[model samples]
Target: MSEVRLYSKADFSECRLTNHPLYSYIQVFFSQELSELVENSTNGTCYALEVGQKLCLVVVAQFQEGQTYPTSLRAQYLDYAQEELALTGIKGKRLLSGAFQLLKRIVPKTIDEVVYVGNYLLSTNLFQPFTTEELQKIEALLQRRFPTKTIVYRSQNSCLNQQLMENLSALNYQSFISRQVFIAHQSQVIQQKKTFKKDRKLAKDTTFNIRTNFDVTNYSERIIELYTQLYISKYSQINPRYTPAFIEAMKTVQNTSFTGVFDEENLIGVTMSWELDGTLTVPILGYDLSYPKESGIYRLLTYYTLLRVNDEQLFHMSSGVGPFKLSRGAEYFPEYIYYKRPASAKERRLSFWLLQKVNTILTRMSNKRAY
Candidate 1:
């Protein structure tokens, strides 16, 4: 018999599944302190789910109008929509713009209420698989709990979660490509890619210092500042606005590591990565962009991270920088979001069907582009 348990913020510490195999990994995101910190910073409310002995986190987010980044469906979908348009050509953008203007009001509000299963508040979500029977029960539980919200499972790629994706599809969840992500084996890149070698040498010979021993708790503010500078100010404000409290909580998490890049004692770059099941995923990475492009700050940060991956481990570099990641022997694949809506919500079903159609076109366009 499979058992499912849900823990809210107030009672998370009471969960008895601490002895579970993935508890250490779960603690990185779902520990009571960390969960509270994340909720305080973002629009998300966190919960812990335990099925049998496997554990994962869930975030129920109510996106407000004009919400920035991934917190809002409009922001998340638009970012990928723009990328797809860019790859196809300007003509596609003009056509899509008019269509978007026509549907903008209806689409955004329809996708606003979301229940993110396995949402770790990171670029990628690492999941411990649930059996089909277990998942069916879990799905029913979520539908009952969040009757009006769209249930979503994100950051799923076939390479990493083929069985899980199959299970979701079997349960009648709709899936669409969210974005292109890169996955590479460290040793193969080190041996085959000349560009990777050059970047490694550049990082090794650079005047800036790399420090893994620095106390992240002490520099939480600086870390958030650098992260905001790149992820929000330069890229898009739609990205999750993580706070210093979130960084400070990371200091005590096991199986996670933080690295800082410094130029003459000033913190210029920082990355926080965690390893699970022989895969290293760097969900938090940022650096000062005020320096000239010739300064090679970004290159140095990328190479330094590559060096941290073990020879046998795979690196899951989250979306964007397609050309840069591809040049270093990373293979690109589409990451997907699997979702389902309540049967009674006819309008939401229609909205999601429309979204599926739009995503299908975008996926086809993205697939045609050379990496």
Candidate 2:
């Protein structure tokens, strides 16, 4: 059996290359810079198993050491830190998060502590193939590792929709966070829904032409401009992820990517995403609402994304944060979070307190009112 070996940096860089799926990891997200970053990374460890020398899964802690370093890393520094870390894979839900897991084996307070941590924004295909049953199995594994009344799984992008939430609830995972996802699924009766007829009168006024995967220069500023406009508008429940600067920096990212509806001379709306590693991630969307009735652009964008990308292993349209998705025909799936405990009681207590602080900081970070 080929062991899933943890290759060091020299090995990672020196390995002879081939036309492997792993090479996909090196593209936009896991650039040489990001790969090299793993060396001095205190927050996390990166691991990969050579799959026939062509495929190497992008694996690492979506986080760094904050007393949560893996047992391996902790053992190396145990005399000084007395920490433990363990790795896990995505049992269900988000791609990057569920793909693999990592944690400190030791906890504070009691041996009762448990941790099943998931991080959003990993490579799109990290969960290459996933299922709900496998997720339940992960929960079962945590049960054997650590017993607990509480588990926490956090998600961004608001991609998990209501039906999925119901399924999870049937399985005992409830929505404890404000984040949400939207879906638009087509069914037998609804399959015959009326066609969206373009108003010829408004068509003349609408000059926006939609395109895929273009350089940010043509529409970067304008896209961000619409985002800023949205920031001022009250429609968006939370528009706290991107700053104009971050949006600008994204352009430098390879596969400078997004789907946009441009109005002749102006950029009317754009749905910006990143092809990180091999996964597609939704960072944000900015649309000119001035043409809600006339634009019909968001609808068009969704249709094309489904028509083109849906066949290639189904794209994650994200959570039900927008009403538009429900009308368009997207299906929602449940995303979950699980937490298992450390063997040590002392570490469990420490983990609890640290988690409290971390959640607070994260919540505030997402709240633009304070920004």
Local distance difference test, per candidate?
0.74, 0.40
Model 2 ranges off by over 4 Å: 6-11, 15-22, 25-126, 130-191, 195-205, 221-257, 272-284, 288-294, 309-313, 344-371
Residue lDDT tens for model 1, 1-371: 88888778677788887766456555656554542554323556678888877788887778665454445566677543553455444346777665555456566565758888887777787777767899898888888888888888988887788999999999899887778788876565554688888887787788989898997988898998898898777776556667787787666666678989899889999989877667788877888888888778788777776775666677888877788888877778888899887765656555556666777776886687634
**Tens digits of per-residue lDDT for model 2, 178-285:** 222333333331233443232222334556676775667656567766765754353331223234444555565553367777766566777766443334445557
TM-score of 2: 0.49
Q: lDDT of candidate 1?
A: 0.74
RMSD of each: 2.8, 12.4
| Ten-residue stretch with the least lDDT total in model 2 | 79-88
lDDT of 2 at 39: 23
- Angstrom error of the Cα, residue 262, model 1: value is 1.0
> Which number leads on TM-score?
1
